[model samples]
Target: MASATNTKIVSSPLLVLLLFSLYTSSAEETGTTLTSSTEEKNVFVLDNYGARGDGEHDDTQALAKAWNAACSSSRPASSLLVPKGNTYLLKPVTLSGPCKSSITFNVKGTLLAPPSRSDWTQDTIRHWIMFQGVSDLTVTGGGTVDGNGEIWWKNSCKTNEALPCTEAPTALTFHQCDNLKVDNLRILNSQQIHLSVEDCANVRVSRLSITAPGTSPNTDGIHVTRSTDVQVRDCAIKTGDDCLSIEDGTRNLHVTKVVCGPGHGISIGSLGDDDSRAEVSGVTIDSVQLYGTTNGARIKTWQGGSGYAKDIVFQNIVMDNVQNPIIIDQSYCDSAKPCEDQESSAVEISNIVFKNIRGTTASKDAIKLSCSQNAPCSDIALENIELKLEGGDGDPESTCQNAKWRKSGNVVPSPCKGSN
Candidate 1:
């Protein structure tokens, strides 16, 4: 009996390693971690921090506690895990961080937002989930963030003009972060913009699936503002508004391998609103497909604004039944009526290149460039363009005004009979 007991205890190295892993997993499951003196605890589980994950119970406090512990850990790197197989209901929360080290928020489960506006406090009316002031962070783990925004959509002023127009909360926002990586997330039914990147730098966002109904109001897939050196790629976005909107103060932004449908196509503004100044430069949008979208590769600015949008390239794009395939509307007005014509201080748009663009336009005018009279667009280049009307009617036409453009290669609809 003594010999048999010793044999069982003295197993092979493989068995010993397996036993150790089992023990560690058991400790994690029970939330029994070793002391920091013995071993650094780097993984903070939401369930261990008292999140029931029942989809009904509020998990806000538990999430906050877990984040705090992970953010304050003395380890070189820490991870906060929202484990799989559970749906956590979270109220409005801002996960602010100036972490002790690099942090990773791994969402392997579902994060469900509150069902209605009544659950939002006055201070929390603008955002549902936010991460701010974090650097060297990575957010991934192939999970779902369900905004549950049906109630908010019903109350939208666009849906019901009788209701007072108010701001709906964005689903996920990252503000003032640097060296961030966000990927492999499915965001559904956002209240407003699905993901907003503001004042961030060196960010990479990819492999995201963001979806809302075509009629859902103001649900932009991704909105970037005041961010630098950001890359957005491999995203499939379908929403009521622009698939991607690059606002003012954005520089060196690159977007590729994107699929957009049932929404407004990628836009470089409705910038310079309220007579404010806007500046955007060095933006390249390539390898994009727009299906049944309202517009394609568009730039829209208000009439009475100052600043410049330049050095932009839209290349290798394909549009299917798009209403406005290629457009530059400097007189864009979203107000209830036509904007009061104030052309005194318009935003300067220049050096815009539309290259290798082939598409089928849903409208008779395939290309419309209506630039500001005071600040007309210059150095607009169109190369290798072939756009035809949907259903093979007569060839599409081009409309141009106050635009100085140059064309090369096979530019169909023949470019409005003007040259550089």
Candidate 2:
């Protein structure tokens, strides 16, 4: 009887099928599925890993665990999901990976940062959320990251001189990542810069709404440095600092269909500071709208720095109430101490074109090209440019120092010439 029972159990195909079905069902319930070939693809939910999503508790450890699981999975495609209708408060965390396969961080809920500056220690917490060395990644879904930066802003030396000055953490920073895509996200009230892309390649960012108070100090909307093949499109950014600041070692960058206001307008540099070398080339900015900005279409390099900025183009720009609508200031000094007069800046500026720019300037000098004397600007061109001053009569004025350029087609304010 025992032998017959064993034989029946061993030969039961229905039992084997039932066990297989249960395994598959279990896998599906755990946000993973098994294919016919028995390979698993994962969708790791944060809640499953002990994330409260209550907006009060720290979910940093929970998020880290989910990321590690998804990143270590053997799946060809995996996703770490922050599900909708919840807020997850996160402390400073670095999500680092060269994962086994392509991974997506699907954020469908709000992520909140610590409210007070005292909650962050400077050396250890320079960025609220950092994604490093990740490739083939997509961060999407209509969500928000709130930096809760009111206290930090109030403590800033720029806002209050009585407070001691300190560096604030960036809201999101991507370092050494490749083939990354970020879209449909809103980053708000950052302690400092809202988004920073550093040493990355093949990055595409679109449809981002980044905002901070106009009085918020050093709150740049997007800061890209030492990156390549980047495309930023269809973004609306209003912040205290530059809407887009492109730093050294960046190439083949394209910015289009952007709207900027209550911020310093898109800038190529404040490069070569403290005598460092800088290089930027192959940049194009088109179809942009700027309103109530400090500047529009600017390239600024410090006096004592060494580098080159070339092959840049700004076209089809419309500005309203912008100061320094078109500018290239070689002697840009923001320090309280006066910049010493020098013969020239070592940074070479060349091959820059501003075309089809129509704007109203808050300042009388709509276009100011103050290039270095020793290394004068060359091959600069202004075509179809028209600018008028806001709340003032007559055509706007342009000033050029040590800059040589060719002009064609409807330049409203005539450009000044350098004695070459």
- The best candidate in terms of lDDT: 1
TM-score, model 2 to reference: 0.89
Please, what are the lDDT tens digits per residue for candidate 1 over residues 1-420? Answer: 111112122223234334433543342332223234222457888887789999999999999999999999889999888887789999999999899999988887899997868889888988999999999999877778999998999999999988988999999999999999998788999999999999999999987878899999999999999999999987778899999999999999999878888899899998999999999999999878788999999999998999999999998887889999999999989986678999888999999998888869999889889998899999999888888899998889998989999887778878865632
Which 10 residues in a row give candidate 2 its minimum summed lDDT?
1-10
Q: Estimate the lDDT of model 1.
A: 0.87
Off by over 4 Å in 2: 1-41, 342-345, 417-420
- Point out the worst 10-residue segment of candidate 1 by lDDT: 1-10
Error of 2 at 152 (Å): 1.3
Give me the displacement of residue 38 in model 2, in angstroms: 16
Which candidate leads in TM-score? Answer: 1
TM-score of 1: 0.90
Q: Model 2, 190-276: lDDT tens per residue?
A: 989999999999999987888899999999999999999999987778899999999999999999878888899999998888888
> What is candidate 1's CA lDDT for residue 142?
71
* Model 2 whole-model lDDT (C-alpha atoms): 0.84
Give the TM-score of each candidate.
Answer: 0.90, 0.89
